[model samples]
Target: MIYLAIGFPPAAKSCAYRMRETANNFVALGWDVTVLTIAEESWEREYGLDHTLSDAVDPRVRIVELPLAREDLATDIREFTEERALNPTRWSKQERERHLEHFPELVFGGWRSALEQGLLDIHREFPADLLLASCAPYVNLAAAWKLWEEHQVPYAIDFRDGWSVDVIGGGEAFTRDSEAGRWEEKVLAEAVAVWCVNDPIADFYRERYPRLAERVHVVRNGFDSDSVPAAHGAPNAEDGLTFGYLGSVNFKPEFLATVLDGWRAARERDPLLARSRFEIRGHIGAGASREANAHMALIRQAESDGVVFGGPVAKAEVAATYGRWDALVLMLVGGRFVTSGKVYEFMASGLPVVSAHEVDHDASAVLTGHPLWTGACGLDAAGLADSFVEAARMAVEATAEQRAEARAHANRFDRGLLMAPAARQLADTVRPALLTGSTQG
Candidate 1:
């Protein structure tokens, strides 16, 4: 079996971890697997690849890198088109419209031809038994559909987040008549199975494609135990309290501003917070925005409040970086449908978490009973101020028993263990089909 996964992965973000685990799982299942994805230089422009994530990939798995690139993530000024650099916001708006002309998805629609051609080429050479398409770029589905239309290779979709369902706002993201809608319905129509990260997302797919209700499966994201440090406790902050956040700063500037305001408010209200430091580690706007974006400016403005905007940290340093933190700040977008991979790792961190997101978010569902969690509240300065205070208390007072129980809660979400059953089911479905095809060929 071969997988067509085109997530802008290993830029030290949520999707990369899942993609790595999925590829690893496929290889461990005693099947030769080939992974088709974009180039390393492309990743450098987007999230900046952490080769550490690829360390665990099975030696047997073949990774075929395409020359494809996401034009949006481009960073170097020398490579920039004069039009893109001068008026990036206007240029991006125009880019989206241009993409919508091809297909509804902006970053992905342009990728369709390249992905289809790549998959077809790979198939011609190796003659794959089964195909798996994971999306975010959604372009992978087009390639999967193209191959299946021509070759009838049974394929599955890892829809980590439902395309039609708006996880952030909790509603239909696009109308059925939309290009992406038509593409999703058509592509998923023949897919052997579809995987979603949470129940709500699965339910959305089932409701949207009632005929394919039986095919949708909920495969929650789980933590890799190796990503957490051996020692389980906050660093003593005699010098200063350290709060860390690891994820993209893709949310609205107002949203980012709210969190920064809250951090400032907390620092003003509490002596402990005043002496504390917040370190944000992740990619900001790619391409021209880079450090020039409003989010980076906001973090820079909060420097007086002890906020540090360290550019993206590599996956190899994830555990070590977390080791220095006194608490976790869960700044997320989206509502009930979003079950970001970071939340699971945060649960395993044994550190107090201050969630700055919608109160009804799916992350709140997972962290509900966590001993050190401060709980979710929409991004409001006042609310976040209270959460920061609560998180400080939790960190100051949390016991060994509490930490052990928190780790136990996350134990159910170990990456390999959670993915094992799903891998088994996929292998079972693909093996028979693969054997039948080979015998016929």
Candidate 2:
């Protein structure tokens, strides 16, 4: 099987975890998986690198690194043309327009030819029985389509978030008449299966393409067992409870500010919160603005309220990070559709959770049965402040049994459990076609 996982391990992106698990699970299911991703230097300019993440990948899986990188993230001035150097902003806009011409995808559509050629070369050397394309450089679909067009290789899409849905903006990203919408329609129409991270996204795709609804699957981004603490330590009330958020700070500045405002309000209202500390551990922005963006500025400004930015944590240190925190702050963006992978990890940590997102969010769906979770109440400062106070109280008064129950609620979402069966099912779906020498398309 050829897996087009552009954000595969070492990329340091949240998608990397899901990509890694997908490829590893395929290998475990007795398929020779080859992951196609951009070179390490490409990741360096984006999220830097996290070599620790590569440790979990099955040794049998082959990694094919393409010589592709995001041109916009170039930090070296020497690499830029004189025209680009003279007017970087205009150059970027022109580049985006150019990329859209080849395919509907922005930033990655230009990679269509390279990816198409790459797949053709791999197929010539070792014919592939199946192809699993993961998106976000939705350009991978172009390559998958290329292979299916030329060699009749069956393909599935790990569409973490469907391309048509504007998750952050809460609407259709593009109309069916638009180039992007047309591309998405074409790819998904022929795809053997399409997987989404949450049910809302899957439902969106189903509603959008009723004829292809049965092909859509909800695979979810589950928590890795190794990343969770073996046993959570008792909340240290003497030194004050520690609240932590461990994920990329990619939300809107206003959203983050609202969370900070709520934290401050909670601190003022509750004596326990006033004595407590809030630690944020994750990458803020990419390239020159990393750890130096408006988010960082906000976190810095909230220092007096006991907020501190601890930078990015290594995958190996995730368990230890969770172990140290008394409670977790699930600061997510979007409504209904956005169910972040952090929600699973936070719940699995067996710590009290304060949801700093919308009431209609899908994370609320996952956290509903969780005993220690302070329910979602939109991002209103007062409501979030109440949530914070409630979470602090839970952290102090909740029994270990309650924490155990909270952890148990997330057991169904263990990364391996969620992915292995999905991989096996895909393998089963393709095996008969391969055995009978029949083409899926």
Question: What is the Cα-based TM-score of model 2?
Answer: 0.98
* Model 2 spans > 4 angstroms off: none
The RMSD of every model to the true structure, in order and in angstroms, is 2.5, 1.1
Among residues 3 or more apart in sequence or in different chains, the pairs in candidate 1 whose N, CA or C atoms overlap within 3 Å are 74-287, 168-334
List TM-score per model, in order: 0.93, 0.98
In model 2, what is the error at residue 243, expressed in angstroms?
A: 0.4
CA lDDT of every candidate = 0.82, 0.90
Q: Number of the top candidate by TM-score?
A: 2
Superposed by TM-score, candidate 2 places the C-alpha of residue 191 at a distance from the truth, in angstroms, of 1.0
Indicate the residue-level lDDT of 311 in model 2: 87
Error of 1 at 403 (Å): 1.3
| Model 1 TM | 0.93
Q: Model 2: how far is 256 from its true place, Å?
A: 0.8
Per-residue lDDT of model 2, residues 324-387, tens digit only: 8999999999888899999999989999999998998889999998999989889899999999
Q: Write the per-residue lDDT of candidate 1 for residues 140-203, one digit (tens) a residue.
A: 7878888888888788999889788988888999988877788889888888889999999999
Lowest lDDT 10-mer window, candidate 1? 432-441
